[model samples]
Target: MSSHEKLSAAANDRKARLAQLKSLKRKQAPTSDEADAAPSPPAHQAEISDAIVRTEEEGEAPSVATTYLSGRNYDPTTRNVKLGFDNLPIADPTNTLEYKAQQLALETKAQQEAENKEDNGLDLFKLQPKKPNWDLKRDLEQKMKSLDVQTENAIAKLVRERVEAQKVIRQKKPADGEGEEVGMEGSELVEAMHLKEQEEARDRRRDEEDEDGIYRAKVRIGTAFTLALHEAISDRGPCDILESVNIRSNPSVRSKTRWKSVARAWI
Candidate 1:
């Protein structure tokens, strides 16, 4: 069909439906006399009907029961009223299980942090002290100084023992005179013994020189250079200091005298 015919048919259908609705309303609507003589509705129902009619005429949807009641005479305090802060339904939310759990977790985390801090402070592995470079240098210097002192003391002790041994050997020479006479019956044996004594004395002299040289070289450094040089040089003809001081006479007295001289030189 044509567009014009289709449109005209739709319009006719709409008008027919409207006419049917008007006839139905005419049949169903109450007559004027019936409306006037009919029993009046209850006051509350009349008010509801009037409200609904007003909303409909104003092109607005009917409000809910709560809205309608609120628009009229609504007093929320009547049913579930809030008297004061203490009368609230869920007053202390802090006492809830979820809140307690959250608080416990936070407290546990804080306690763990505190314990970790304390452990870090006290733990030997973690509590390493960080010394400065200067401190380390000072400690090293002190250790070196102590080691130097110990070495000097050890050398001095060895020298003292050697000197004591030599003294004992020298003292035993007198006691061997009787045996030496009996043993020296032959000239060849006497000459050999004499040569042996001379060689032993030379070896002792060479050992003494070597020992003094080593002591002087090893100890002569910094403040001890002057003292060691003075002690290594003899007063007689620039030879063994021990011989010049007559170490065999009174060694302790000579050592004390040497210290006094060093102190005087410093002063």
Candidate 2:
């Protein structure tokens, strides 16, 4: 394409890309609805407006048995009657005043009986302690005996220490054994035995240096540089070979050749 056409195509592509980005951003924005714009508090159940309990109507009216005669002039089938002074029944002279004497006598008897039975109950006394079993007593006795023994040992040690601290207290020298018993060995014999052992050890010094029985193999990192320098300068050869090694430098020499193994064990 020509330069002008390429530039125009590039500009068109850039504009198309910008338009697509703007459309994507618009799709990501939030809606304007009240429920969607901001968060709202959770809804709760409505409060109860009425009482839980209800009572029956108790107007100035009393109910009676329908089958019994009321003994006064009134309608037999009437349900509710308004209470008034004229409609109130005459109080019987016998029923109310007759029970007063018996009620007083009963009240006196009840008060006396209540006073006789008045007690705080058996909560004041402490309960008896439970008896210990045989095994528990035995274990307790054993522990006590052990404690006694430890205490006695401590006391005896303290007494002995105090006695030793007293300067006037003298220890008795032990009496010599029977007069004819043999005497102990002299120091010369110990010296002679020590010299013999030294001679034997000198004879086995080289074996002690080589053998694993008498010598401990050691590898220390701190002396690594010094050891390398020491080994390089010293005339010490490699480990003693279990087999042999041979090189093919002089091939024509019909000498018996051993394997040139690289398995050199280090000390």
Candidate 3:
């Protein structure tokens, strides 16, 4: 036989075999009428329905439901439906996803509230240039005390120098042509002291009139005047009415005089 004839004959044989196989399968399998006449078991029926649904899903011509309704009563509720999340809003009756979303919202609100609270935003305790209150107070007090001591020492040195100057004037002889110099120096010293007192009094009165309401110049000036008087007495022997007034006002002068007298006696 020619190659073309053999090929045509093989094709015809394949078609015949396929047709026989299909006929044999049709004869063995139950048809829709036979299925209606004899009821199938519940499990077998469910399996058959599942297989039909699977086959319909794979077919090109789609069907919403591929179940045979002729054998049993048709149930509209049993037909398959096309469900997609493309159009419908997402929702779950179980409350799992909604609960999670609500929980996240609550967490975000809590964070916002915490951030809005004043205490959470600023840390008052960690301020710049941090120092303990007690330590700062202690350091300031020490500085003030040191400054006070330094000021007192400077004032005392000035008083001692003045006293030395007065003593030198008193020791000089009048015949040496120094009498005029001594009188001038004493007058100037006394005048300066009087002017200082008057200026201090004016300052005190001015302080009272000032809006700041701070007053201290009076006590300071009086203390300085008293120190000057004491130094003068030590240098000039406290012989005049002024010296008597100073001794009356500052009775501590008597103890200083007694201590000086004892030292002189011992020497």
Candidate 4:
């Protein structure tokens, strides 16, 4: 081969070897940096989740102590402890003279206010002089006089009506010996008497019919029996005959008669 061609071949071989070495270095590089650049772990995630577990066998976290101190820091003038005042071992702290003085001032102010309120309420009850007004007694007396006059008028009207009613009654009353004469005339008074007599006659006929119907019903009932006797004697009629007589033989017929008698008395 020619020298130039051989030199070109040598250079090509060196370039190919250099390229292979570069490729090998890239493949062999550590992957940790790339992984770290990709993304970081979230802060809220546990650092050693599966490895560490909370258990009762381990000691608990310390309890936080509560305090009731009011100041930002300790005051040497007050001789207050550096620790929180709420944590100080004192009971009934209000027993201090300053606290008692404040309480007494509040109570005194409340009492003064209560006294002022009571005084104001009393002022409301104080009687002020009434104005010279119209005389109520005189006005009432005048009204009473007027009412008496009205009452007298009302009574007079009522008396007049009663007198008129009594006159009408006297006029309408029949004289002792004039009853038969009044009935003999063919006037309205006689017609009224004739109507009254007709009503009374109708009532008497109804009573007689009722009595006859009662007697006939009783006789019918007695005839149903074979031994009982029934007899009815009325002032205006003859006696009813009992065809059969069974009630006399029945002992319960006496009790029935007593019940009927009681019912009639009640009616």
Whose lDDT is greatest here?
Answer: 1
lDDT of 3 by residue, 132-247 (tens): 34475588778889898997798679868877886776677455656676677689779878987998799667644652332355666556556655555566553443434434
Q: Is candidate 1 or candidate 2 better by lDDT?
A: 1
Which candidate's TM-score is highest? Answer: 1
Worst 10 residues of 1 by lDDT: 233-242
Note each model's CA RMSD in angstroms: 31.3, 42.4, 30.7, 39.6
Worst 10 residues of 3 by lDDT: 62-71
Candidates ranked by lDDT = 1, 3, 4, 2
Off by over 4 Å in 2: 1-130, 133-135, 168-267
Q: How many pairs in model 4 have backbone atoms within 3 A of each other, for residues 3 or more apart or on separate chains, i.e. clashes?
A: 8
lDDT of 2 at 230: 49
Q: Model 2 scores what on Cα lDDT?
A: 0.47
**Candidate 2 lDDT over residue span 4-75, tens digit each:** 999688667745744554464457555679548777433320111011011112222122222233424544
Per-residue error for 7 in candidate 4, Å, reads 99
**What are the models' TM-scores?**
0.23, 0.14, 0.19, 0.17
Q: After superposition, how far is residue 225 of candidate 3 from its true place, in Å?
A: 48
Candidate 2 is scored at a TM of 0.14
* Candidate 2 RMSD to the real structure: 42.4
Tens-digit per-residue lDDT, 42-84, candidate 1: 9775666666556655877554442236433444446343444
Model 4 scores what on Cα lDDT? 0.53
TM-score ranking of the models: 1, 3, 4, 2
